[model samples]
Target: MEKTTNLQETVHSPKDEGGTTLGLSLDKAWAPKTEEKAETEAGNDSTGDAPEENHDYVTGYKLALLLASVTTFFFLQMLDMSIISTAIPQITSDFHSLPDIGWYSGAYQLTSATLQPLTGRFYTRVRAKWVFLFFFFIFEVGSLICAVSKSSVMFIIGRAVAGLGGSGLQNGGLTVIAGAVPLESRPFYMAFMMAFGQLGLIVGPLIGGVFTQYVTWRWCFYINLPLGGVAGLFLALLHAPDQIKKPQVSFSLLRKVIPQLDLLGFAIFAPCAVMFLLALQFGSSDYPWNSSTVIGLFVGAGVAFPIFLYWEHRQGAEAMIPLSMVRQRYVWVSSIQFASLTTSVFVGGQFFPIYFQSVKGVGPTLSGVYMLPGILSGLLFVLISGSLATKVGYLLPWALFAGAGTAVSAGLISTWGPDTSTAKWVGYQILYGVRGCGLQAGVITLQNVLPPAQGALGIAFLIFCQNISTAVFSVVGNTIFTQSLVKQITALAPSVSPAAALAAGGSAEAVRALAPPGSPELAGVIQAFANSFDTVCYLLIAAASLSFVASWGFGWIDVRKKPEPGKGDV
Candidate 1:
């Protein structure tokens, strides 16, 4: 009865100061007329509208629970993404599918990137609680499938499925956070969620290492089940604010909502994304850079991109990329900056462990441990930046800090040699961590600059950029590393077959066994690995430097100040 009352109130509420109630702005065709009728018959105001006020119904203890639920899944999804890096070797060894390794991470990222903006529409049109819950379950099912996979094909399929769900988790969390909190206090909460959420990135490799070494690699996927269940349970029990809106489900409503999903734009963009990523994944690795297959994929992506843009323009508000929103300076700039930053991070996530294993000759567990200095330092700055943003009311400083820090640290890492000291490597990582993590603060600035209606879509678009860039660059990083290593191995260790070194699947253990430990040939092989890593680090520096340049465009906005009635956009 109470649930029914809340729904009725939300259904009839006037647009609040933020534009609309978080979950309550469903189209008339999608809302339940019967509920409104019943509330009217019960002597409630037939208007059924919530009171006009700025009070946040989702505050106090409920908000805490909400944060916990959303952040938990956020952490788990990130952990799931990063953990697979360390376990890739075991997965390949078990399936004997070294050539297919790119697809494992690529599949997840592809689906996640493609589905992200669409999920934003889902949140806006439907109840965010159900949407979040649905995606969380999908993520769990994907994890289950991954855990039970017997072949590379099945595992990649599972990863793509998980990515589909994981796409919603972060965006959904941010969307919910946006709706539930007041504008002034949002930076702290956003920072808090992101800081702890990044702990997954830190612990991911560590946990993956332990599971891969002592237990089965499958445990990496299995671990999500219990944690996700807890998050799902909380979401199920907690309710959106009474003023929050939700879409009503029916066949007629489905017809309206389906088109609003802009499937045509997605159809165009999905192929574009797939083709481009496939080209990168295959070029100079699976196929010659000049191969017909590689050229065809690139050509297809290039052709499809303009068509996708045209389609999105036609769709207008229904579009995934929404040109209306994209035209805004802040939206596009933030998207590009976020894309570059995350691209570098994801590339680093994959290759850092490779450097530890192949170049430094450390095992998976130790490699994860070695990443802590950077991860911990990054987390500390994320927190500090968030707190400072909330207090100072500006966000550009954080972006500049992150961008400059990332560029410097990544540039330093490019100098790493086969025999670089532990102190140097650790120091470089700390430099990257301190500023790299400050990007979280930028989220507050971006979201704060837009009205609530636009903010959700903006956040989704930002996430889409991040994921798509990560997917594309991961392939680029792999291609560079593989090509460089093969070339260097041929030059440095002429007697060691380059193909054999490549086939060893980049396992330090397997590569070390090629010649006696401490022999000149073994040293050459290690040096080749280090030199290849240097190439990837240079790539990171370039991406990070671009991100720094992009940061300069975000005009300093005091996020804590409430925008005047008509001043949301820059």
Candidate 2:
């Protein structure tokens, strides 16, 4: 409950401006005072206790400007994650490296998921406003690197760097809100922030397509420069109280802080995650399932995961994923549900463009346009879920709805063939959007149910799970799509080499160029691509089903009312 910063020593007295001070400490700041002091403070008009409670409740012009920055960064970060999907084809063609497509997407999420929890720790143990700005700058730098990269390896490196920075923006947005706004109004603010992000998520592919088809795929990364600059400016102008204690820069302090970061846990986890995903991506394509390379990766991941868990358990409070937090029902369930549902979203987003371009014979720009049905519907449902959660005080219905609805929609999507009508595709997307809407409601529910002290940790853990799932599932989808396309095409077109079809880049244009337009092999190529897409959709269904089972564990906690003082908010 100690003050995060020495406000009395570092800042001017609050008496000069309406007699208030920043309520900027963690859970301790909200702790109840002794009975005598509480009674005395209540009676003393000069102590300014009432005004202190309202000090950090940002409002009017300042609130608007702050939200503008948060929304911009949210959009940019989400956009960065998805924009690469449409650009991948052109990127692969340019580099002449089709086999490395999984790295292009998975690399970003790899660093993002692994670094997210550590960033949460940084926000808690440092001057968070500065940390937020630092992360944004890093993101901007990464975009610039991506825009100018000359090779696939360079671009993949840029993506990993960008993810390291992006890990902070979305999570930092929530942290800023928790610090500046009271608990009662958080859901509305969270909804507004997420709506902006959803807009980015939906528009990302379209932007990437336009850039790739009309100009160059590099523009997708170039667009981030000016937008990020504007967001950075707004954030710089805002003066906010520190949310946590700032560590003084010194070798001694650095030594202490390093251990608190649980570097050992991260060391174990990074390898574990990489090996697990590498094994899945390599199996059946680059290597046989039982090949030494694939088996070695699996064995490494299996060993690393347990070691990571053991290290984290031993680290106690400093653990990347603290054992205490994971044990809580609301925390673990929310993490699992968010991870599973979002994996479906990531898998669909990754492959939907291929479906449109390869099966439907659409150009990149038009393929992005075709994806609008799913993205727009998903955005609409996100806002609706937030509104419903705010009004109903319960999130269980939305979770249940998301799980079952996504499963059904995924099954429907899997049934789509080369001859399927546009209406059916559009309808299937709308059905899947139901799951998208429920995502943020689960976040709101998590924030509401956990104590304020635990909020940062919970949010970080959820982000980590979501990102890691996205990374793993993107690779899983990519491997499945590539392997299926090769197998199916080889079956129907014995004259077409599997390598040639794959190298043509998973689209109709590539297939058409490889086979004569009237040849039976052209039809088979398209069918193979469609079948590959269907595999991703089937995986989506399984992920959604697992999410449904996880949602049931959320129980019936209502978050509408504020918790009483001294209770741990749950």
Candidate 3:
């Protein structure tokens, strides 16, 4: 039976002395102690650093189970994001809709990027366990829809729904750690979790290739059902410690949900992103950059941008990007670093596989193999960075090293040619990924600076920037790749229409069939693919360079040096 107690979760800014919480649930043994929070807050100093009592880390057997469960889901979530890469060409062939290819990836990112901040807020207000499971179920349902999709439209809808659900997993996972893990030891667990999550990115292509070539393209989505079920079971068994907020429940909590989550601000903000990204899509494809449709979308995004900002300003602390919290130097700067690094990473994600398949003439299965050097190197460094950060008591150096190192690597990558030796390509990937330390740059900095009360929202905002960067830059890369292909094919293979050569049915095997090796058409098409990747890599260089600049903002602050139990530290 539902209790008649008050049910409120008051999320306050860092400057607030202490947060208030109210809930309507049967008294549970593990619920956060309200009295302990007030006592700790009264004893804490001016910097708003969390007291020792506030670091309620779940330890021993529960910690092990929690980490394992989180790792499993992280793998599934990333697998869901990436498995489609190798299978997209076949998927397009089955549905006979080349124009819809962008939607397959874009729709997922759209819902993910736009909706995550509110999900972050939800984490703060409600029971995080329930919220995490809710999104997990949503993700499973979306995957089921995709597996059964018979038309391109159905697949696109499924992708959008999956994006909405999968958006919460990564952010939610990090939020769990920030709340439950002590600051003194947060880096290792955070980094370890992230390192494990990245494993999915490495093997995703191989699994997708095996499924698509040996079975059916639908198996790519089908794999998630079984894996996600296992992860969900594990997540259910563990009682993950969360932020010290009263448990929210009952019909009153339902009534307060809209305002609590800032749905109105999201309504204004989501359209801005949709319209802006649509403009990029339209201008990049058959439509000219100057086309009326593209211009209108751009103008609409422009107008909405200011309106959204103004709305957030009016909403203050509850807004998607809280003005007071983000205004802090460390939070804003780290966000920039995160966006640039994530953009650079995704630029490679979007275009490098194309570099292997189309330019090198490697088949889908082999192309995945070729991308491994980078993924492995990146994964290795994530673990190393985490351990080093924990041991050395500094995070800025790693962030700076990754930022500076990746700029040099991305610059090197932009120079590849169609006949570039295997040695150069593999080395470039290692060079790019050796800077994997960049992955930990943004979130660790955030967890250190924000109060525990703002933990979920801060993480949500940081990832919101990253999701937006990846989504926007993916469209930008597609624009570069498509436009460059059109221009190069026209100039180099004037007799071969770019449309036919770039078609789903016309890729790889068709190119070899229509224009055998040593033929002028084959040479032109391969060179076009080579030149297109080089253009896209320039964007990668720019993004990496910007990340390097943002890295300087991390400064020399020691992440592990928490203040005395009653003292403030900033």
Candidate 4:
């Protein structure tokens, strides 16, 4: 086998030029001594046929079609993740299930996180198109299951199934892009795909809100059927290529890959994640932080993590997450920033509704409507930053500004009280929209920094970190809000019992029934909700501050770098 030398090349555009020219050169490592090998490989007739040496293959149109196909998959996957937020209240009501409400979301997240890295590796060992097509079908089946689900348990099972498939879409799309395109072109293409993904995030909530209000919440899951089916059919028909390498499914290959699957790590990691999230969900509402359940969860996660780390190290190359990648400074810093950004976003998503409904006296419908500005702004920024990254070759500045803006927005929102003006609240939401631009843009940056060999795995890890952080922070934010609300209500309504006030806070009708007209207890309830909002906002501000520090570590990488001759594959 001839070995190709890998060399890095950089491209620079003249200030006067409107666009940068990235030149790629492919050179044969060794001149062919015979024509028979090339002829056989090319599937040309061998009867007096000569093999073409050093043929340059270009498929601009085919690449475009493949990208479009992958983008559709990406959109559907991300949309499902956030779409349920607006329909949560409705879904819970319809099923008459509250005990496992969180599981509807948490189950999907947990399964996805646990299976992500495995899917990434699976892509390397399987044909990209086949693997994607198989998983796409799985996802569609899951969606259909959810659409017809009559029970909460059935719905959760559907979500779990969907999550298993959704985990593949992100990594699978990237795998296809990596296989189809040259190394230097990836960032630009990645930005394009990310824009679509962000669009799904933006549209998901709005669509869910609309469906829940006007049509039916079931439509939210049903809608994915047509969109996903079209994308999958396109992939199966036009995008599937014969040129891509298929994995050798030998017993030896299975032995190597199966051990690398890290089933033990997943066993430890998944339960820890579930326990931690459960503890977060139940700690303040159902059990105290110091209670046996909460403490045991914390202790279990703490013990499992170090052991998991040691196991990863011991497994070395066979580990699901390689120790070397985890130890990289860029990886850790980027993961922290990504995780923190997600934490802020999730916290905001969870409580902003409460702020609108409880403190600002907006109805659920209106509150969902008010959230549109921030979501739309974030979508716009995702596109802007992605485009900008292609041109500017750096994302740190945008990350820094976004982090600072998020902190400022959170700080401003934290000051809200019963008397706060609606204009100020709307203004705060706009600031949040601006802040979201940075967070979404930062994802492309982190994905760009890792080596191409680890592209899928790296992307999965980034997402995993984000999900874990979001789950944990959501729990913490809830705890903070509940504690602050309780404290404030108790202090203000010394005459009214804490238990009575809590009972009132549980439902709007209960609160109205318990409090007499213009009573001190009613006033106390209002004050308590406001104080809780303020506390959660302050915590978000702190998270944003940490995001700023993490942004600094996003080392600059020039996306315009010229492709070295004969070094097309990364």
Candidate 5:
């Protein structure tokens, strides 16, 4: 065990030169040193620690302010993603394009997911601040387009554009925090950022429901204009630590990296994602399991995935994903946990409103109101868990608790009958709120474990997993809903076919038209939905259990130890 004193001297001397000094100091001098441990565990390989020069400097308060702004931007971006779900029914009716309604959500998700890796590269090459501002403008433009959109195509286009900007904003929020904040202070700032994002999630549905019921769905898009303007303005005005040095764009670098980008990998990856999402959304309704489209999609994803893996390994250093990172026990396990947690959230998001509208007979606005408890719970937990993590320096127990709580809450909520009491329902929502707190805390823990230089890349990879998992699980949950509904409806009404029942657009109006007044068929529909919800909850529970395993895999890393005098933070 050894203690270092390099930081004290560097802190006192302020220099305008290109080099910036960072030092780490440990309070407990007897703890086993990082260098000694690394030597014993692996070898004497240098960890690429180099002194940073001409570093961009910003005040801590200013950095915090900038973090807040970016977090708000992220909140708005995600709000637009989920807020529209409740309003889709109304939007489709007004536009008279029910058939193409899925596009509204799909377009945003597909484009955003596809561009995520590219954005990670872009951040490395370009000034993040200007890049963020550009995206902000694009987001505003997309919102304006949606606000005035006269047709479904126009709205889809607008959503696509918004998705592009949102992809950047979401990634930028994490990247900026990683770049600007010291490792120790990051948890606190991350908590604040995540809280803002949860606030947006809570508000988005409620706002969307209100606008859809009272005003128009267009307002959902219109509202972003003013909010985004304010956020972007603040960010543009603020100064933060700049990590990107001047663009060192080199043809040689590109030549070395271009093959690693793996265009073939994307060709396979993109279609697999799109097809799989389509299978979930349209399966059993528009296409059967044996149908050519569904079969083709599943088979394509199956075949392409292995090829992508082989290419990734072969490309090695130049690969889009560093295989070493993927191979790390901590990294892969954390990523799996992250993916599972995201799946749980996505599944819940999809079905909770259905329960409110279809079973509880609540309007869209009230459904959003029902979601409030979960959102608030998540907000509170994110704050507390973050602070706790900072103080205690351990994240496993909290993550396990969150996973278990989420599973239990989902299971309980799945038991709701058509006549379930509102008080009981609210209790389940509270459990969901607790779940939110744990999820964000676990994410921060994963980020904290990585070296600071890889922080942004780690966050980006986690987000990539989240996006892919959400898309895939959302599709699976939808499939469960459709399959259960068809089976239940067919059993209750032998004369009516599944296709005929679904043809009415899965709306309450169509269900009423198909079932006679006070018939057993209506009860069957309710039962079918109950079964579907239960199945999804069970899946979430399984994921939560996996999260527990992943949480336990976290290894110890000391953040307080300072590097040698010449060794840089990076």
Candidate 6:
């Protein structure tokens, strides 16, 4: 076992306050040292986190600040994802383009999802800190665009831009932790970051509701600017080492970097994914399922899907999502489990507002309150699950619990009506949130299975599945909700035109004004909306159920067992 002597080169920058180096030439930073391997096999370090090894990872006061900055940035990014939900009705009112509601979230998710793989490559080949800062800048710009947009098209474009930046925030968060901490302690830190994100995810709508009511919808986006500024300031002050390092920043490195991003694979994939989702989005609503536009999209996606797979297969090591990594049982299983569980969260977040606003006749602000229990509980469990997994050294129990619990809760949510008690909805959401807590633990398990070099890519692949499926199924949920609303309303309340109600700025106020609350007409509409929500609930139920099925594939690996030095960090 040979050792690394001078593979690392440190350079002091002007920003170094107390001798913290801004650049580390970490070509083989983690390359196994003969002495370190021996110490590891001998179990000398009682606590896995504080090994008697020096990799020059960010430490001391700097470590605390770095972790806080990343976690706060993540919280802001997540807040962006759901905060827009409460503002959607107001946005459509301002833009007078009610039909464009889907495009707002859709565009963001699309850009974030499609560009995710490339972000992975970027992190792996370049400095994680630089990649993160660049993406953060993009996200802030996108948020600014959203805040000032005067038209629907501009707003959608802004969302797309924000998503482009959002693609890297989570991946970057995980990458930074990987660089800074040992594998044994990563789950707790990662979970700590995720717990804050969960808080953001759970509370986003409520915050959006406050902005839409007291301030304005634009403020929801404008709020990101300040939070981003704070995070950026901290990150700028502390330029820590990256996980996969290049010798130095140069134009020569840029030449090699472009090809590594797999531009050709992305070209083939982006359009195909858009086409497939558009088909799902437009089918039976914008156009007949048999219409040429819809059919062409489906056919195009079907053909291109296989072509992209083949291209990726041939690309092998250079592929956007390395097939070698994808072939691993744990990697694929973790991806599926994470995607399904997360998709359910996204779908439920969107649908709950509809139920609260339209069926129960609550305002947007109140709806967010109704949602707080679930989000808070989910946040609590995220922290608990991460901490407990570290202590117990096992994660499979949580995985199984996530699948079974969320499924049951979703099914219960589907049965709710306008008259359903507050206790029931609160109870159901708590169930869903606690059950879903175990999902984040899967990422830790995934990193344990892959090779050392592929860590960022593995994280990116998981994010891609999550973003793509959430984007796809959000549209699907929209379609299902809309079709059901139209069909059910037309039958139950013949006097009312569902189109007119939706187009009346798509707000609860609009629908409620069509008839008095106690009238049979209003009752019929609420019932119809309630039923439509059930279909959307079914989508989540199915997604959560799939998590259970994927849980079985995780095998029986003990997460406490550290990966070999040349392999992964457990």
RMSD of each: 7.9, 9.0, 8.1, 7.9, 8.3, 9.7
Q: Write the per-residue lDDT of candidate 1 for residues 311-409, one digit (tens) a residue.
A: 887766556766766766667788888889877777887888778887887777888899899889988988888888867765667787788889899
Top model number, lDDT: 6
Question: TM-score, each model?
Answer: 0.87, 0.86, 0.87, 0.78, 0.80, 0.87
C-alpha lDDT score of every prediction, in listed order? 0.76, 0.75, 0.74, 0.65, 0.63, 0.78
The reply for model 2, stretches above 4 Å from the true place, is 1-55, 241-256, 563-570
Per-residue lDDT tens digits for candidate 6, residues 55-130, read 5676688889998999999999889987887778777767765556667777888889988988887877777887
Tell me how far the alpha carbon of residue 564 in candidate 6 is from the true structure, in angstroms, after superposition.
10
**lDDT by residue for model 2 over 325-350, one digit each (tens)?**
57766677888898999998888888
Clashes of each: 3, 1, 1, 0, 6, 0
Clashes of 2: 1
Off by over 4 Å in 4: 1-61, 91-104, 133-161, 240-256, 436-449, 489-524, 563-570
How far residue 292's Cα lies from its native spot in candidate 4, in Å, is 2.8
Candidate 5 residue runs with Cα over 4 Å from true position:
1-57, 92-106, 136-160, 243-272, 275-285, 493-524, 555-570
Give the runs in model 6 whose Cα sits over 4 Å from its true position: 1-54, 96-99, 561-570
Q: Write the per-residue lDDT of candidate 4 for residues 284-307, one digit (tens) a residue.
A: 567887899989988887888888
Instruction: Summing lDDT over every window of 10 consecutive residues in candidate 3, give the lowest-scoring window.
Output: 3-12
CA lDDT, candidate 3, residue 210: 79
Query: Looking at model 1, which ten-residue stretch has the lowest summed lDDT?
Result: 1-10
